[model samples]
Structure formats: structure tokens, C-alpha cells
Target: MQQLSWLPTHPDLSGAIGQAKRIEDPLQRLHEAVKLAAHQRDFTLTARLDKLAAAGIEQHAAAARLTPLRVALLSSHTVDHLLPAIRVAGLQRRLALSLHVAPYGMYRQALLADDPALNAFAPQLVVLALDAHDAPLQLPLQASQAEVDAAVAERVDELRLLWRRARERYAAQVVQQTLVPVAPPLFGSYEALVPASPRAVIERLNAAIRAAAREDGVLLLDLAWQAAAYGDGLAEPVRWHQAKQLVSPTLAPLYGEHLARIAAATAGLSRKCLVLDLDNTLWGGVIGDDGIDGIQLGQGSPS
Candidate 1:
């Protein structure tokens, strides 16, 4: 299933865009367009906004309130497909992002080696997106809890070191993407009790990661929990087996949105503010027409 384009562009978006384009000031026109696009989650909308926002930023970045942010994505899997969505999502929050993607499978090496190119970029935020299959822990299916505990500790310890390096080496905020638990249950309901089971170890690693992240003041992408929330929409087994794309191309846009939200928070530009209309929302009917006494209020009205 195509997750990215799950829904077509809204039928009314074109009319809305036409109205926005009619505005005399370019920045104001772009502002209105962004306001409309920010509330939508569609591939077509993202693509258009990606281009439009880029040009708008180039012309009136400061006036448009486009906050410039430098981001680095160090991943063990393919992530190029997700960039457009990330940029568009940033624009939604009025952030103008500049990104650096580490060489494939070279996430650790780049940071460890202090690659010249990466150092040149000097990213303000670093995202570590390691895949579960890439973890070095190798436990027998029947291995003991002690063995599982040691492996989980070692993996998270290495991650802690990496997080520390990111902060000390570059003064960058770190966002660790939790290892996705893609392994199928080996013993059905009994799997949780078996630490050596592939799924169990991943879960253990995720828990350890969260604890360490909290202690180290590192932010978490928490893919393990995201997968639980996204269900089958997070990824497909076929894509993983065939192309090593840990994230499904169909859901790449949503994935980008998730990452962008983290970036926004780090920049203090997170989407926390909300505006709402009161009609039929805080009450059962329009407050203006019905008035306070006439509107539904905990059995106070029509009773």
C-alpha cells in the first residue's frame, strides 16, 4: 500500500492557493499558502510546498519568519526519500532547514572519524537513525537472561558514548531513533519472557535507551513506540527484505513529519500552540446563537 500518497490532494486546495496567490505582497501570499499547507498531510501538498517555501525563503527569509536550522541525519539505511517531506514540515513551522545526510552505513564512522565534510557543515542538530538489524548483539534463541542483559547494556552504552560525542564534539542536540522491533514472535505469547528472543532484546534495548536518553539529556525519536502507534503503516516486511529500507516509502512523508517535529522542538519552534473555534466544540451548539444558558452544558440545557 502506498502510504505517502494515501490521500489525494484536497479538492479545494487549488481554489485556496488561487486566493493566496492573489495577495499583492509576495511574503503575505507565501504566508497564507503555508498556513493552508501546514494543516495538511499529503504527498502532493508537501512537494508543492517544498518548492514554494524554498523560493519564498530565498526572497524573504527574515520577513517570512523562516528560522534557519542546520540538521544532520546519520542513518544506517536509505533516507534520501524522506528529505523533501522533512523540509516541507519545517516550513510548516516557519523553519528554514539545511540538512546533511551521512554516507550510507557510515553514520558511526563519520562521527568517529570526524569526517571533514561533516565538520564543515557543523550541524546544530544530529539525528542517529540506526536500524535494528545493524545492532551487533548476537544472542542465541535460548540464551539466558544474563546474556541478554549484558548485550542490551553494551549496545546502550555505545549509544551513550555516541550521544556524548555529538554534544561535546559539536555542541549539537542529539535525537536517537529507537531501534525498530521488526522481529516476529518466536514463541507467541511466551516471547516476552524470553530475553534471548530477537523481539525481546530489541524491546529491552529500547527501554534501556529511553532511560539513558533521559539521564544524558538526549531527545528520543522513539521508533519502537511509533511502530506500535503506526501499526502496519510504519513499514512493510517486503520492503525491508528487498531493499533494506527500514522505513516504508509510502509512509516516508509521515516519517519526515515526525523527525521534523523533533527538530522543531530542539529549535524551540515546536507546534504546541493551537487555535480553535467555539461553535459546537466547547459546547453542543453555536455559542453566539444559542448563548451560554441555551447551549448544552452538562445537562444544563434542554433539561
Candidate 2:
């Protein structure tokens, strides 16, 4: 596999992971496994950790290491695949997460009607994620700027109402996901010039969402920014067509990691300190082993 460049390395990581799993004590096993999992970023490893953490929590062992956080995931599309990964990612930061996901297309119903189950779960953090397909304008290719503005604003206002309701009713922290730009370009480069194209309306809608979120003190998951790096592969057209999965299940681990961070932040568990290694981080290669000149740094060097 592919390596996640951002996370640092761990020597004999597989061996360490295997050893951690054999600890017998479910609580201790999960604690050790989470520490090892943080030293590397492998989806396979992430999946294993997810399983371990779930088992540990289910066993009802000593939970001193786990910080409890109840989360409400209100989304327009299917997000069941991302739950395990989100739980494990939260465990990496010592968070024990419990999720309340709105059923099917019933997210608005759950929030607006204040569904009894959601009210009982009492989420401390609420995430609102909508897919590109959920909100679309019925306007023409050459509609006026005013027409586009009004349509986009109406969608933003609807979301704003939901955010305010969640905060007021539950006193929960709210996070909004920027809709992924999965809609393909219709007019190629000329698409940007069209005032009322689907892409144009979505772009304007996302802009309005950012402004609304800021004004309402809503934290943003910024899925649009994350989707920009993965291109069409991130959304996976096949899964979207067959299962209505806005994000591919293959990317559940990565998606969960990001979502968990936002959830953790709401709980005041966001990383406050980062300690870096001098050898590989400050200068590429080992300075002591390779000597000073062999290290990559400064002009024409890679660090």
C-alpha cells in the first residue's frame, strides 16, 4: 500500500500491533493498540484498530482511557460505512464515541420534528453533511445572476435554520459539511461563466454556507476542500450509482479520521501540542548516520 505521508513511521509496526492485540485485557489492549496506530497511517491498520476499539468498549472494561462523546450525524446520504472508522479515529485521541445517525433521508425530519430517539441519545456534537445531489437548482444554463443568488441563498437559509435549532434545542456543538463538488463539468471551462449552471450554483451555495456557518458559530467539516484533492475517485461514481454512497466505502478510514478530529475539537480534545523529530523532519535523511552534508535541507534540498 499507499502511505499517508503526514503520519510518522513506527518500526516493526505489524509486530507491535500483533503483540498489542494479545494483551488479554480488553481495555489495556485497546489502549496499547491506539498508541501504536497513531505512529503510522495505514488503512489496513486503521480497520484493525477500529475493530479492537469496538470490542474493547463492548466488553465494558475499565474506560479511564476513553473520553465519552455522543455524536449526531445528520446527513442527506448513506453514511453507515463511515461510522466504525470514525469511532476508531476518535479512540486514537482517547475518545470513546457513540453515534446517532438519522435514518435514510430522514435527517431533516429527525432534526425539525425533534425525533424522540435523537432526543434521547442527546448528542454533544452534531454534524450536518449534505451531498451535491441533495441540493440542485432547476434553473437554466443562462439564468440571471439575481436568480442564481436567490436560489443559493434559500438553500443556505434552510441549513442555517437547522443549525440554530440544533444549538438551541440540544445545546449541542454544530458542524456543517460543505457539499462535495461531485457534479461533472457540463460546459468544460465555459461552465464557470454560466451564472446558473449546476456547478455555478453549488459553488455559490458553498460560499454562502461558509459565511453562514461563520456568522452562526458553526464549525465546518469542509468536505469540499477535502474532495478537491481526491478528484472523482473520492466520490466513486460506481458506488454513487449503485448504492447512493456519496463517499466511497474504500475511503471510510480517511473520511472518518477527518470527521473525528472535528468531533474531538468540539469536545475540547483537539491536539494542542505537536512535537517533531529533528532528524527526518528538520532535515531529510539521518544527519548523524549520513553526516551533515548528506542531509537534505536549505536550498535545492528536500526536508
Candidate 3:
């Protein structure tokens, strides 16, 4: 685990407190002082500062308890815009922030797994950024904004109600973490190994693999469905047609992106060791008969 010194504070509260401290009114000064002390970096303060700050909030500042929080940020695009505000709040409240990039669907699956350590982080809030062009609808910007705002307001209200219900069921011991779904992956990979099919043996093997994956937790992204959608009667014969269809210029980039996503997801999980059948794969000539120099590695000989 990595450690960084910062705390999370409410931006609204922090700003209000800062403004309040500048006012001449005794009541306001006291309010602001309490706010400041509540969000202060260090616990140690002189009796004079504590008394002055505490009296304003109508409560003893020292008696206030602060909980350490962990926040995880999941997003596809750069979240640089929110970093400044998040950082300010973090510094004020002493929080730990972990940021990750992944497709929204994948993150949703991960959250549903329900790990206690994940819940303890307790991401209570989320900041989502979306581009209109990427998710275009028939409506114009003004209309879309109104629609989006209403949708978000409704979601917030629904979440509050859900939280209340969850608290009631679990009591104070239940820890709640927020899962915010963002835009889907712009690029992802789906793969299937179809044997020389219509050949009953090969088709059965393919079906079995698909079935097993479905039974397990793995998502079996059916390439056959994709082929049916994209290929114009071009994917029927798996050995010849599907292979040829894959090399088509229109499908190359899509295929490449899918393969890249799968590779990225499984990266660092295990080592891939390639064992070459050296007789045909590495050198052209038979190693038993040919001396090292006689072997057809780089030379023009068609061994």
C-alpha cells in the first residue's frame, strides 16, 4: 500500500468557512473558526484558538471525530479536470485516493463481487464526465442538458432512499460504497475459436468451450454473433471464410482493438512462454544433419 498525506473535505463547506472567517460579525467568526478547526490539518492547537473556534460552532471543536476515508476513481478518459478540486478536498479531510482506468461494464462486474476491502474504501461520491458527440442523441445541447440534469437529480434522490433502506437493513455496521457507471469502452475485444466447423467434432468442441465459460464467471463474448452482424455470409466456413473475413480491412482495426483489450486485462497476471517446434518453426534445415552454419535461419535457401 502506498501512503500520501492528504484528507478529504467538502468543497462547499471549506469555501464557506474561508469566507466566514473574514466577516466582522462575532457569530459568523465563531462559525467559521469552528469550520476551520473541524477541517484543520493538525489536531494540536493552543487553548486560545480552540476556545475561540469552538464557541462559534456552538460545540467543542476537539470533541469532533474525523474518520479516515479511501476513495477510488474509475474512468476511461483523463480525469485531470476534477483532480484539483478532489485534491483540495483530500488535503482538507485527510483522504487516500486511488485512480484506475477500465470500461464501465468491467468495473460494474468487479463491484458486484463484494470484497470487504473494496467496500472499506467507501467511494461515497463520483464525478462522471461525458462528451455529447460521443453519446449523441437527437436532441440539441440545451434540451439534452435539461434532460441530463433531471435524470441525475432523480438518481441522487433514488440513491438517498436506497442508502436509507440499506442502513435500516444492516444497521450502523453496513459499509456502503458508491459504484458510478461511466461510458462504455470505445474499443474492446471479443474472441472465439471455431474449429473447421460443420465438421461435427470441431463444432462440439467450440460449443463445449462456450458452455464452460458461461458456467464459469468468464463472459463468453460470442464472435459468431458479431460475424453474423458484420459479415455478409462470409463467416460460415470457420477455417477459410472466418479467417479470410478477419483480414478484411474494415474488420482489422476492430479485431485488433478487441485483442488489445483482452491482452491488457490479463496483463501481469501470468507469463506467456512460447515453445517453438524448432525443426520447422525456427530453422529451415534439420538440426541433426546440419551444422550450426548449415542451418537455414537467415540464408536464402528454401530448406
Tens-place lDDT per residue, model 1, 1-303, is 344343345557656766666667767766875676555555665665665555466677688877888999999878887787888777777787898999988988888776898899999999999888888588888889998999899989888888888888799999999998777789899999887888888888889999999999999988888786566645567887777788865676788778888988888886565777666665677778878777775554322
lDDT tens digits, residues 1-303, model 2?
233446778887777777777788887877776786576555567767776666677555246456788899998888887787788778777788899998887778888995999999998998887888888778887789999999888888899899988988899999898988777889899887888877878888889999999999999989888776555446677888888888776677678878888877877888887788779877899888999889888654456
**For residues 1-303, could you state the per-residue lDDT of candidate 3 as single tens digits?**
111122234455445555665676655565445444334232122122333443333232223332223233333223333333333222223222233323432333334345354356454332222211122223322344345444444444433453343334323121222221122332233111212111222223334434443443233324433443434322223422333222233333232223222322322222266888787457787777886777777555445
Best by lDDT: 2
Q: Which residue pairs show collisions in model 2?
A: none
Better of 1 and 2 by lDDT: 2
lDDT scores for all predictions?
Answer: 0.79, 0.80, 0.34
lDDT of 2: 0.80
Compared with the true structure, the alpha-carbon lDDT of candidate 3 equals 0.34
In Å, residue 114's CA in model 2 sits off its true spot by 3.3
Better lDDT candidate (1, 3): 1
Model 3, poorest ten-residue lDDT window?
Answer: 190-199
